[model samples]
Target: MSKNNKEREVTAGPVKGEFISPQELNDIEERTDALPPQEDFWKPPVRFGSVPVEKEPLGWDRRRGFRKLFPVVSLPTQVVERVSFGHPELEPNRLFWGDNLHVMRQLPSESIDLIYIDPPFFSGRQYNVIFGDQNELRSFSDIWEGGMPGYLIWLNARLYEMKRLLKKTGSIYVHCDWHASHYIKVEMDKIFGYGNFINEIVWCYETAGKSKKTFSRKHDVILLYSKTDDFYLDVSKSPMPRKRNKHMRVGVDENGREYEEKTDAKTRKVYRWYFDEGRLPFDYWTDIQFINWEAKERIGYPTQKPEPLVERIIKVSSNDEDVVADFFCGGGTSLAVAQKLKRKWIGCDQSRVAVALTADRISRLIEEEIGKIFSVPDFTVEHWGIYEADRLSKMPLDQFRAFILRAFGAVPDDSQTGIHGMKGAIPIYVGEPNQRSQVTAKEVEAFANAIRKTIRYQQDNLRDGIMLAWAFRPDAVQAAERLRDMEITDLNFVRLEQIRIDHPRFREHVAALSTDHADYANFLTFVQPPKVEVGWKRLATRSYIQADINKRTY
Candidate 1:
């Protein structure tokens, strides 16, 4: 087992005050007691066994090695609204449109029962890859490259988040190619531990044509790991057939009923013969075929694995109503399977093309024609905050405030007078050059007074307070702090920002458009889904206004 690293490093926004002197810094540091070597910060600890990685040279060894050791760190206690879909009549299936690292960090630890990820394999060639629109391609290469070390770094960061998100009884299946499977296996061992190592399933499929000299490779590795010794594994559904003929029967004559199997070699006792019973499958599997162009589940995407493969995994690792997640959901294969099998699921991908296509595919799969007594869910597609706020805000004022507090990891302050930025998950407000006073302390105090009244009104009426506010701000932190402290006892506040609006120009454009169409008010409130045809123009060149303020990277 690898030793847990105990280095204490602050990796978040700086505190308000700074060290006045070297001695002051040293004194402050000395006075601070080391936090108990924190274990599993996100959720309950999951115990996983490990296994030795197979020795193989990956295409990007150096990059993978770096990633295996130092993964991307996550923002502490930040929250983003979760995106979900599927009809209420059906199970809860979600689709997240952001980075999985952030999403997993927000999720409660040990929550998901099963996870199946088909992460991008670090292959050298990628031309017209599936889900490769301009935006998606940029994100893909940004995450997948820098060679083996880079890929490992990316994978390890995600894995740490997964470790916290998984249930103690949960299991994870990591799918990969020959290019980086070995390195990934090593990383998994370090993260999940060698004791939880389960199976190395070989998904073998046939490829046409013969190799001239070397053997043609046509299989992928599925490394399975469990959270603990006692995990949920439904082996009965997909057990292998027993190879009766392969096992030699003792005490059996050449061809007669007098022959019986030997009970024990030393005892040589005759036992009733039992053969042809199905045996459980081992690590290597070769039955499932890859998706072909003519296959029913084909969705015009390269590297889309068959539904059967995912189905088998979902069935074996989880039960009905159990939540499952797939961060690298390509064509919604996992989502489709999860919906059909009655499991709650969340699938994420960077591509808008993929997201739209996945939504369409899932809808189609659910509506497959059966008979007159067909069933369909009241399906609803949602983006990020607005959709969730629409649903959650329906609760009473106190309840809604609680929801916001829990989600954002910050108490709402009614005093701040501006709409928070929805897409960026930051606190900001709309403003003009002249309306800067809207973010002042006086405004915050006034807003706080209004919230106190609203809380009282809600208490009297037994209803939730639902309202919207927007302002322009020059400083967000000071404004946010003022709001945080301006509260009547037990009555917090929530600030929501418009989703799709970017700059003041976009805000002006939206206001102009909204004035013309009152009925489309709801559409403008939430973040807009990606527009495929949008183009960009370069900004005018200018001299350096200020040096980059980012901390220097070592």
Candidate 2:
């Protein structure tokens, strides 16, 4: 699974070769599944087989009468940036900068094969603010408000969406620790059926922060769960080499391979086992070490996991060309590893700084590490709920119009001349992508005439119109006002509203949602790109400047 074989070799069992073939492994797995639960434990699982898929946004637990709810909202993506590797024809993998719950809601159901998320660990400490961004800070604050229950509720909302996005045969690996693993497990059981539980992997590593009062807490827990009963599993993908045992009776087979013989005393049947086949893994893993500050893969993210850790999970869960996703991408360790492993990936992070850093990290890998055989040629970084006006102004004309229509919750209809879209019996016109280009009186007149020629207008079904642009010329505003006044007295009355892109009413689609929570304040916000200025001055004399400022351009 990793380059450092010795460091990742947790154990080599004495009995390995007996469970190599597919038939034997399948038979063993079947028998294990048929066994009954322990008498002292194992309560019956909740029967959610008939709970319609549309109700996935509704949360529940094993006990009745208690429900945690999530609102199903669709905030489409805005392409912020696209990193290219010379292949323009390939579709770009997506990286989103937004709340993952809203982002995942827009994704197609059952599209991803593997999902690995490392969300906030609920440490309730200041160090969790790694990027110092308002969005990241808000997420951490919201989760820690009501203590354990609050944290679980916040995580369960996203977890429910993740369950909807995962394929029927997919797997999810959640990396957490002692803080709230037990609570999360019960919630996951309620979300993903309890019978689909896979393993509670213990990743052991030694680091500083040893305590004298109790045993040093050095291990992190990884809870793995599947979406369905027939999920895929291929342990041989992560092969573990075993050592030879001298006590076993070893002999060479006819094919010049080493083998061990096991004889059934009653039937006198001898079964041959091969040594080259791989061994199964233990739930307790100590081979892979934790990433220190000086590690090469470390990019300064506080909760960044090692690439090898994600690599093993991806290799075992998904195949090549399969889609992998990471909803809480801290430093994008999972995404980077997936790209190198030839798997298409999608990643989302709420912090702008983390998204920027993750994009840079992946770009560096594309330029340096992933060589000629790189199959992943492009990926796009998109923003949901939050948008960049500077980037939006630079998009192509058609792209900008489509994005505007989607953002306004309107259906784009480019078939009619001068009318770009419609929203509930109202015609809409979109201006140019360049913000400096203002809407003209001629354009407004043309849209009015075009709508008058439409069947909906002749039948008296459409009487309203909305014009969206960065700015409207005075002549255009006057034309719209004149049309509104003149048409109201005539047989067909038309109301046209000339609205700028920066108008608060432009965000009415998202603003009308339930705003009972304070976190919705940042959604549907338009942020301007920072303005940078550079100036140079003549500094002929070195003695005139300080040592620090002297090194910079003057």
Candidate 3:
């Protein structure tokens, strides 16, 4: 059933109406107190069924894998940074990354308004892991070890998580092909309930590959389920189907016969239209097409879905400001369209490659004419925070060190060799969990003596007692021993942990580097049909002959 919604009520059939003598009616009404009340009789009967539940056969996990939750740190709010290329000028609401599982875990519960994920069908590992990397190719061997039952288990866990995260009013669309569509439908029905099952959409597409021996595969199944009865479906935004009458006239003829007829309001011309004309598309859809080489929006990604396709989904299922999420965000197409439509979105993908490409596409779109008109909140051009490193990297080493001492609350000293391997020139020691951000003890010892001497000299000469002197480090306990009774501002260190970077952060850096290695790189690509080459034909024929001989012998 839809989340948090109750089933419709049913009442018992009414008794036959009859007139009786007044005395008899009063006696009957009084005597009828012995009978069960009408409300009690109308209650729903208990459900009865004898259906066996399927159980999975176990014995798969011989070893457990490693799992850790480590926090990632980001620069502070006041730090302003900028980069060229790959970083999108505009921010999208949805992100599609490599691993849907990882992304889904990060999402907040009941945040999304709608979700439509077309995960792989369990159509054999060879077909499912079409991506041609060693990892994906080997995934077939690894996944098949457990078989379809195991596959069901894997999908069930994901579905459970999805159910938990969905809002009460949200909806989900699970896309699949013939291979496992039926099984998935059953599973979905069980999880979301038979009552919540919205539609079984049959999406048909054209296929040029003729199969004389069997039926041509030309359609996919989409199982739509709502979290609750209440959900947004924007009807006005959908395109009107051709061959529909523009207007209808309801009137009665001179014969006193009522009829409803299609008409053009202005011309009053009688129009013939199909019963289904101008109606919202039902479960079976035949208009959408698969991506091809000539498609204008194709960006050379293997699984890049079309813009119009996603755009239609955005318009129909969501409204402006509503959240849209995609866990397996590949090219960020959903997010891009969602942004255009003014919906907030969250997209996740594991592959660094996919994230980078998507970020680049979004950035380029913003640079064009559209970005200026629409601006997403939290992402603004006016206030890119300032990071201390960007400004310090330009200064000379000595001058930089001097500036760091005075600027970051560190004592000025010549004995100090700066901290190493920091992105910024001024190395701010990020403290451990629950500890304040501070400079290390090594630096304090090296610089405090010289910094104190410099301050003492300046203070004695200027008669202004170390006004510019400061110390920035995590452990102020030791610094107190060295600087003793002196004015020292201990700038607390930042906790490096707990910060998370957006998709654009690392992507921008990676994109700036040359990608000449990608061509030679072993990219994971999905393999389509016509896999047979010249050498393979001979091998197949030999195998066929051997199989025939074996069959004959048996």
Candidate 4:
């Protein structure tokens, strides 16, 4: 919601450049005069024998049809590529890079079983990327010009879509902090109904910082709400360690299990506590620790929640293979935990870097957990508001040319003789619209000729030039090679592969693990499956070394 300095300020009354001619104004006045006078035009029509409507909920933004605020750009539907690790028949999970509102709209209603979103908490600050090679410096702003109202509007729109996506028995968990949490709770009550409100979990963690103004804010609020009263919840999955009673001593039962009994002083009632009865987790959580810098699970992402935290939520809310979704999946912690728990997941984030890191992290998890070679959990990577192959093929010549140039980080230059744009003095020429077909030798020769002309006729100093196309024919590659040998012009013909690599839509395929069956078998025999816990320390160290070697070799 934070506005950039370059953003234009919105004003009321009339938009600039919108002018009504005198004749046009006169026509409007004439039309108004022709109509017969009636009752107050703004008054609501009276209804008889209709169900009495209750007063509209207070604090609710009754403005409907706000989807118009965001123009829907037609994006090409990407083909879902399967990259199976263990189960090929299982429905592939999905990872999307776009606004969650648009992505949720595309999903079918009443399909998802569980939804967990850790959206921006209206912190009035920018959450910048702390790690990741590409987007380390990028930041997401939580500031809103309209303040709480604007934040509510933005979140309410997405929550409305999410509610529709949830099944009758589905549940949602919204994570937030003190800022705007009260407002969000009110908005959620209006949307999900107060009757459906569940527990509000307090996730408490220990950190270094302390506030001098008041008590240190050490906990976050996670609001849990179900689509309906009849929702799924397995609290038994997340049990806490039972605390010992100071008033009673341990006694042995008939089953040889330790038990403790305490007599209430006021009520004179005896209560027995067995060691085997696992205690249910309270609404307030402090068992799970926060991700520290030295933790192995730390991926160096800002605000990355610990895996155990999300794992508990997933376990409690969803069954195996149930579809779970995280709209604001910053580092994909929810998606990764869902996958590990054997749940189908859908995650979306606007940051390409976050998506990239999530894909890489998930691939490594698949490798380490499922022990698959050259495989990852099957999932599709998609970009919204970007042209796909089908749409690109149908686009007009000029528009398509412009799109290609812009996608390649170049400006379209019709003024240039042959080059489309200049990328830091390097002339870029977009090949003909061939729809993934090969670029022929004739096309390559024409580009070569243009470069030669620039060097000879224009007296222009040209070091190198590039030709972008769908694919290059063998002869075309040979021609470019021949020209490079002659030193006339160093023309590099870049094909779709290079472009796709540079602008990757899917996670790069992980290298196949070395298939040393005998060695693996020997190690397994020595460690034994039953003793894995005892030997994991040594095994993990060896695995880490192997992974490092593979990283270097690959």
Candidate 2: regions farther than 4 A off: 1-70, 89-91, 126-128, 132-138, 239-279, 373-375, 394-402, 410-522, 527-554
Rank order (by TM-score, best first): 2, 4, 1, 3
TM-score of each: 0.56, 0.64, 0.49, 0.59
Ranked by lDDT, the better of candidates 3 and 4 is 4
- Candidate 3 Cα outliers beyond 4 Å, as residue runs: 1-51, 55-98, 125-141, 243-278, 377-554
Q: After superposition, how far is residue 79 of candidate 4 from its true place, in Å?
A: 4.3
What is the C-alpha lDDT profile of model 4 across 1-554, one tens digit per residue?
11221221212111111111111112213322121121221233465433332222222323423333332222223322234455555466777755566566666678999999998778877554334333122333332545776667667767876887899899999999999787787677666776778999999999998999999999999999998889999998988767778888678888898888888999989888887785799999988878988998887667789998899999999998899999889778999898788788898885555665676566667756643443334675554422234434555677666655554556677665777776556777776565567877787777777766664335755647778766677898788788778877777765543212122222111101011111211110000011111111111100000011011100
**lDDT of candidate 3 over 293-327, digit per residue (tens):** 78766766556666766776778888888887665
lDDT of 1 by residue, 443-544 (tens): 444444444444343465322222222332334335445444543322122234433323443333222221121122122222222243212311111110
Distance from true location, Cα of 254 in model 3, Å: 28
Instruction: Please tell me which model should have the higher TM-score, number 1 or number 3.
Output: 1
lDDT (0-100) at residue 237 of candidate 2? 82
Per-candidate Cα lDDT values, in order, are: 0.50, 0.64, 0.44, 0.61
For TM-score, the strongest prediction is 2
Clashes of each: 28, 0, 29, 0
Error of 1 at 455 (Å): 29
CA lDDT, candidate 3, residue 321: 85
